[model samples]
Target: MFYFDATYVLLIPAILLSFWAQAKISSAFNNYSEVRSINGYTGADAARKLLDANGLYDVPIEVIPGKLTDHYDPANRVLRLSEEVYYGSSVASIGVAAHETGHAFQHKQHYVPLEIRNSIVPAVNLSSNASWILFFIGMIFSIPFLARIGVVLFAAVVVFHLITLPVEFNASSRALKLLESRGILYGDEVKGARKVLSAAALTYVAAALMAISQLIRLIIISRDRD
Candidate 1:
């Protein structure tokens, strides 16, 4: 509930523009994906092909319920695709599936950045949920110590966001290079896939920026404490 300053106002437009750009990119990729398939394969099929091609056939691909809920869990070596992403035969699906497969490939190679990011997951998960709760309680009770605890907890979230960036970027980079080199996507399709992955990457960037902004806000609030 803080007033918007010049810096925040500038950031608001930047974030909004990025979101708008991403929406356009996503819509374009979704349409292109639905219209074209490298081998006329579904998302599941594409993912399997990529995994097998990389000698990662042991990686399992499963369909979960939802839209755009696809993710790869290195721990279980499972590539979870949402119903739409798993079954749909679209350029978007192919791109997404390939992107996730990239993560699997990274794991196979023991990618260091991913290893670091994965290592912090539990701590990040715990902190993101706990921080605001602690901050609220501390504020309500007029206790500086609880607010300080919230500050510490939020630090974990900021760190997590920073760590996530490289992991995501590398995954997308791997996907793009693989798609192009393997002819998984042709000319326009390659461009579209790049757009899709790039836009998707921005969401993470936005999340990190938001986390940083919130951390700054919290610090400002702490400074105002009597």
Candidate 2:
């Protein structure tokens, strides 16, 4: 009953922002991906250099096929990059690669936010799914308490997204700095790299906003039932 209620309109802004974020990242990445770095280091090469410079020689970088699906696997301590990023020496590729490697830096240094984020990941995973189930069942049965519980659970998802902002931003900051310092990108090239990372960061911001919007909608619906 709550799913398609007037409350559904609350999501419009977030939905629009999410679309804008996706488009921003795509445009920025595609534009910069065409501009090769002066030093000519592919994403993988830049990542390896950064990792090795930080004494993270053991961490491995692997290429995976995809478009901007790159990520750092903290558990396995491996960095996986998309085909474009792993091989392309473009500004966007190097920027994305450096951002993933930045996560490695955080891991090696035991960055507090990163650790905290990792610790709650399991709960967030469960909550993300269970929150909807509980909310739907509660709304269908008019169990305000159950729906409220769902709201609480979803709050964790929101928290995860919030913490993710700083983590992602910090990693991007690190990547930009490292890229400049390492001479992988300089002057206008560094500016382009920053643009790529900044665009990517907005996607995280959009996710956090969407999560918060859902939580607020759930709270309103549950409170009405109460």
Candidate 3:
């Protein structure tokens, strides 16, 4: 019955877009990953160069397992890079690495959106876990008030997704600019990095759309029960 729900009409396009975005990122990353940067600097090296240039000597780069699992941990002030991006000298690798480093820069500079997103993380986690439980239980028991609460809570997820768009775009923009200005990647190599980052950005856009669509579905379902 859940799978057969009528509201899925609102979800299908976002779902399809999510699939397409994933495919685009995979293809773009894999393709550009093969094209080595002219300077032959590994992803780790690029990250180190950026951090050092910014006088962030305390932030260490760690080797994290899995492909494309790279991220910046603000709490510990560390850069965690996936195996491919950590050791790779390819354009995609450095681009991804630089992107993560960009987060550290944002953290140091106190970017407002990043700060707000971090602050809301606890509530978002609670809302994500409990929203569905409340919605389903309310629907089962015919309690419209509880169902309305669920929809409101679910809206938090959409807000989080919306906030993520600017954070992601800013990081990618910083990465590309730093890569070019510092000569980490040059000429057509920067183009490859841009392609990779652009494809990656689409995934966030797709996620935001999916979150919005899901929120709409929840609202419609809640209202129908009223």
Query: Candidate 3, residues 144-207: lDDT per residue as tens digits?
Result: 8888888899999999999999999999999899999999999999999999999999999999
Each model's Cα RMSD: 2.7, 0.8, 0.9
Q: How far is candidate 3 from the true structure (C-alpha RMSD, Å)?
A: 0.9
Tens digit of per-residue lDDT, candidate 1, span 65-154:
876789999889999998877887777888888899988998999899789888988988898889988887876678878877898899
List where candidate 1 sits over 4 angstroms from the true fold: 1-22
Local distance difference test, each candidate = 0.80, 0.93, 0.93
- Full candidate order by lDDT, most accurate first: 2, 3, 1
Error of 2 at 71 (Å): 0.5
Per-prediction backbone clash count: 4, 0, 0
Mind giving the per-residue lDDT tens digits that candidate 2 earns over 100-195? 999999999999999999999999999999999999899899887888889999999999999999999999999999989988899999999899
Please report the TM-score between candidate 1 and the true structure.
0.88
Q: Which residue pairs come into collision in candidate 1?
A: 33-90, 33-91, 33-92, 34-90
Error of 1 at 31 (Å): 2.8
